[model samples]
Every structure is written in C-alpha cells, then in structure tokens.
Target: MVRTVLVLGGTAEARRLAEALAEAGDRLRVVTSLAGRVSRPHLPPGEVRIGGFDGVEGLTAWLREERVDAVVDATHPFAARVTASAAAATSALGLPFLVLRRPGWRQAEEDDWRWVGSVAEAAELLPTVGTRALLTVGRQELEPFTRLSDVWLLARSIEQPNVPIEAVLGRGPFAVESELELLDDHDIDVLVTKDSGGDDAKLVAARRRNIPVVIVRRPPSPAVMIVSTVDQAAIWVIYGHATVS
Candidate 1:
C-alpha cells in the first residue's frame, strides 16, 4: 500500500529527506512544502508545494484533503509558529508526525558566547558586548537590532533586508575561509546569530578572532518525535520506528 507523506521543508535536511524518500520508488508519495519566503529557493526532488497552510485549521484541512498518511517537519528550527501548527494539525488528525531538528552548536572552551532567549534579548545585550557586530540572524529577525544606534551592524541575507543596516547578500553553507574574510574585513568585534545548528563557520571565525558571539536560542517547540539526522528521519518515515543508526 502506498502512503502519502507531507514534509514541511526549507532546510538542507528537509531536501535530503525528500530525496531519500523519493528513492523509495512506488512505495511512497512524497510532497515537500516550502514556506515561499525565499525569492529563489533550491528546488528539491519530488513534488513540491510553496507558501503557508495558513494555520492549524488550514493545515489540518490540507492534510485531510491531500490524504497525507504521515508528516515530517524539517523546517528551520526558529520557525516556531509553523512547527506548533504542524504539531497541532497532526495531533488533530491522528497522523504519524516526526520532527527533524539538527542539533545546535556547542560552545567550545575558547568561545565567548552569550546565550539569550530571543533575538530582542540578543539585541539588548549587544551594546554591552561590542561596538560593531556581524549579524547572521537572517533578514526577518533583524528588526529588533535595527534600533541600536550605538553599535554598527553588518548583516547577511539571501535577499535585501527591510531594515537600514548595511547588508551583504548571500546564501548559506558558507565556508569558514569566507567567514574569516568577512570578520577580518569588517573588523567585527562581535557576531550575532541564531542557533540554526549544523554548520559553524561563523562560530569558528569568531573563536579564531577571539570575538564574543551573541547567540539567540531556539524557541520551545511542541513535544513531538524528533530525529537529529536525515537517515533517522527517513527510517521513521519508512518503518514507523526510529532504529539505532
């Protein structure tokens, strides 16, 4: 029997999960949903849908309408609302749900890191730490830091940020060499970023420069079965159980 799976995607893991599931041949029907936030996103293999499902009500209706047998949320960790809605919608439908969350970066002994609960809190703490900051917290989350008059800010984004801060546009999986160049060229004294996990180029660059880093912690997510790797998540989607890998 073929099962229809809905994957809430936007991250590299999500794409990888979709690719893995697509390799299942006729056994499974995979549909990946993107947030449509990026103007040009790297299209993943298999069927793809763009934009929001509105909220829990809309998501529940979509799931029902699509006849989705299971759900895997591999969205950005900071996407709290989307995650919450997915959890709620799946619960209401009694569907098998899984969360693919990459583990967050660990603070090394040499790294000077200030952990904050939210982006606003990080912005508040930035003034006390350094005069200039390199912000890698994405374009949407930059509003909180825009009001700071004392600290000079340089931000990076896939698209231009709405705020007045100076920004360099680029997409991720950024190399440490490029990161080091960015830090050195800017004379950056501090780095502001979210705990998106996986790659740690910026973190490494900051450590090498002995610069302080203000890390915005991920928001609390709804309780769900979570797997830290694509292979584990793929196993869950296929066999309905997480096996030791």
Candidate 2:
C-alpha cells in the first residue's frame, strides 16, 4: 500500500528531505508545503503547495483530508506559531510527527558575541554597541530598527524593503568570502542574526574577523522527536511507515 507524507517546509533541509524521499521509491508520496512569503522561492522536489493553512485547526483538517501518514516540520527556527500549530494539529489527529531543526550557531573564541532572547533585545543593544551595522535578519522585523535613527543599517533581504532604513536586496546560502566582502563594503562593525543554524560558514567568517554578533535565540518547540538533518528525517519517515505497514 502507498503512503502519503505531508512535509511543512520552508528551509533547505526540507527541500533536501523531500528529494531524498522521492528518490527512495514509488511506495511513498511526498508533498512539500511552503509559506508563500518568498518572492521567487527555489522549488523543492516532489509535489509543492504554497501558502498558509489558516491555523492549527485548518492544518488538522487538511491532514485528515489528505490522509497524511506523517508530518515533518522544517520551518525556520524562529517560526514559533506555525510549529506550535503543526504540533497541536498532529497531536489531535494522532498522526506521526517529526521535526527537522538545524542546530543553532555557537560562539567561537575569536568572536565578540552578545546573546539576546529576541529581535527587540538585539535592536536595543545596537545603540550601545555599534553605529554602523549589518542587520542580517529578514525584512519583516526591520521595523524595530526604525526607532534607532542614530544607527546606520545595511539591511539585506531577498527583495527591496519599504522600511525606513537603508536596505539591500539579495539572496543567501552566502559564501564566507562574499560575506567577508559584504562586511567590508558595508563597513559593518556589528552583525545581527537569528540562531537558525543550517548554514555556518558565514557565521564562522564573522567570528574570525572578531565582529560582534547579536544572535536572537530560537523559540522553544513543542515536545516532539527532533532530527538535525534531512537524511535523519528521511530515515524516521521510512521507519515510521514500516511500522505502520
């Protein structure tokens, strides 16, 4: 019997896991769901569905309607609401659930680091720390920095932002050499990033230069089995299906 899997994906790991599952066999059907926020999203493997599912109740209804055998959440680490909704929906439906979360970034010896719990905290620290800054965090939270008119922000995002601050439009999966160049070009004295750690080379480069990084902590996830990689998630999916078979 064929099994269907619903993957709540927006991260690199989600795309990788969906591809792996597709290559595994014909017995399993994979559908990857993406939040329609990114302007031109890199397409993932298998079937792709874009946009939100209303909320937890909506997600639960969709899961049942689609007959999803399992769920793998690969959202951004700071995506607290969707993750919580997915967990609640899966639990209510009595469906198998797994989380594919990339590990958080760690502080290095060469780094000048100040950890903060949220974006607001990081924004508050910018005045005391540096005047010229690079806000590596996404465009959505750019509003908080508006209050800090004294600080010069070189903000990077996929598209041009309408925020009051100076913005640069670009994409990432950035190389360390390029990141270093960007740091120099922007005259960035301080960096702000979230702890969603699928990529590390850039962070490592920042650390090597002794640039202060104010890392926003990841929100706590619901109680569920967590795996660090796409391969690990694929293994869990196959194993869970085997048991059901």
Candidate 3:
C-alpha cells in the first residue's frame, strides 16, 4: 500500500529528512512544505509546497483534503509558531506526528558564553561585554541593536539588513582562522548569536579570542515526540502510517 507524508521543512534537518523519505522508494509520496522565508530556499526532493497553511484549522483541512498519512515537523528550533501549530493540527485529527530536531550547542568549560532570553536582552547585556560586536542573529530582527550608538555593529547574514550596518555577507561552518581574522580585522570584542545548534565554529573562535558571546535562547517549542536524526524520523513515518491505517 502507498502512503503520503507531509514534512514541515525549513531547517537543514528538514531537507535531509525529505531526501531520506524520497529515497525510501515510490511507496511513500513525500511532500515538503517550506515557510518561504528565504528568497531562494534549497529545494528538497519530491512534491514541494511553499507558504503557511494559514493556521491550525487551515492545516487540518489541508491534511484531510490531501489524505496525508503522517506528519514530521522538521522546522527550525526557533520556529515555535509552526511547531505549535503542527502539534495542534495533528493532535486535533489524531494523526501520527513527530518533531525532527537538531541538538543545540552546549557551552564548553573554556567558552565565554553569556546566555540571554532574546535579541533585546542580548543587546542589553552587550555593553557589559564589549563595544565592538558581531551580530549573527540574522537580518530580519536587527531592531534591538539599532538604538545602540556606542556599540559598533558587524551584522552577518545571507541577506543585508534594512538599517545601515557594517555588514558581512557569508554562510557558516566558518573556520576558526577566518573567524579570528574577522575579529582581528574589525577589532571585534563580543559575539552575538541565536542558539542555532549543530555548529561550533563561532563558539570556538570566540573562546580562543576571549570574546564574550551573548547567545539568545530559542523560544519554547511545543512539547512533542522529538527525534534527532533523519533515520529516526523515517522509521516513525513508516511505522506510524502502518499503525494509523
């Protein structure tokens, strides 16, 4: 028997899960749904849909209409809204669902990490750390730092911010040497970032330079069955559909 699965895709893990499901054979018709935040997202294999399903009601209607057998919420860790909505919609229909989460970074003994709740809180804490800062919180939410005239900003993202910033356009998996050079070149003293896990390039570089890092904690995701790997999610999808049917 054939099955159709909906994967809420945005993060790298989401794309990986989509690929794994696609390779599992034609028995599983995988559909990947992107949030369309990025102008050009890395398209996943199989059927792809973009944008929101409005809300929980809209999503439930869509699932029923499409005859989705199961769902995998593989959104970004920070995407609390989408995760919560997925949980609600799936629970309403009693559909099989799971969260595919990539683990966050843990602070090492040598790490000079100052944890904050949000970007605004990070901005408030920055003055205590350094006057020159590297902000890796992305271009969308640069509002908190705009008012800080004393502290110089080095904003790094895939796209540029609307507000004037000392910008560096680059992607991550950043080298320690490159990070060191960037810090040295700009005389950067503090690093600001979201707790976007599965990477440690900036954390290590900051530690080596004795740079204080102000990290914004991720918003609370809906409490649900969470798995860390694509294989784990795939197994859930396979077995879940069987159980549901």
Q: What tens digits encode model 3's per-residue C-alpha lDDT throughout 76-150?
A: 788888888899999998888888888888988988889899888998889888999999998887888998989
lDDT per residue (tens digit) for residues 152-190 in model 2: 988888877778778877777888898889888888888
Instruction: Point out where model 2 deviates above 4 Å.
Output: 241-245
lDDT of 2 at 135: 87
Poorest stretch of ten by lDDT in candidate 3: 236-245
Q: Supply the TM-score for candidate 3.
A: 0.94
The local lDDT score (0 to 100) that residue 178 gets in candidate 2 is 86
Q: What is the C-alpha local distance difference test score of each model?
A: 0.92, 0.85, 0.87
Once superposed on the true structure, which residue ranges of model 1 sit more than 4 Å away at CA?
241-245
Colliding pairs, model 2: none
- In candidate 3, stretches whose alpha carbon ends up further than 4 angstroms from where it belongs are 241-245
Q: Poorest 10 consecutive residues of model 1 by lDDT? A: 236-245
What is the TM-score of each predicted model, taking all chains together? 0.97, 0.95, 0.94
Query: Which of 1 and 2 is the better model by lDDT?
Result: 1
Candidate order by lDDT, decreasing, is 1, 3, 2
Best by TM-score: 1
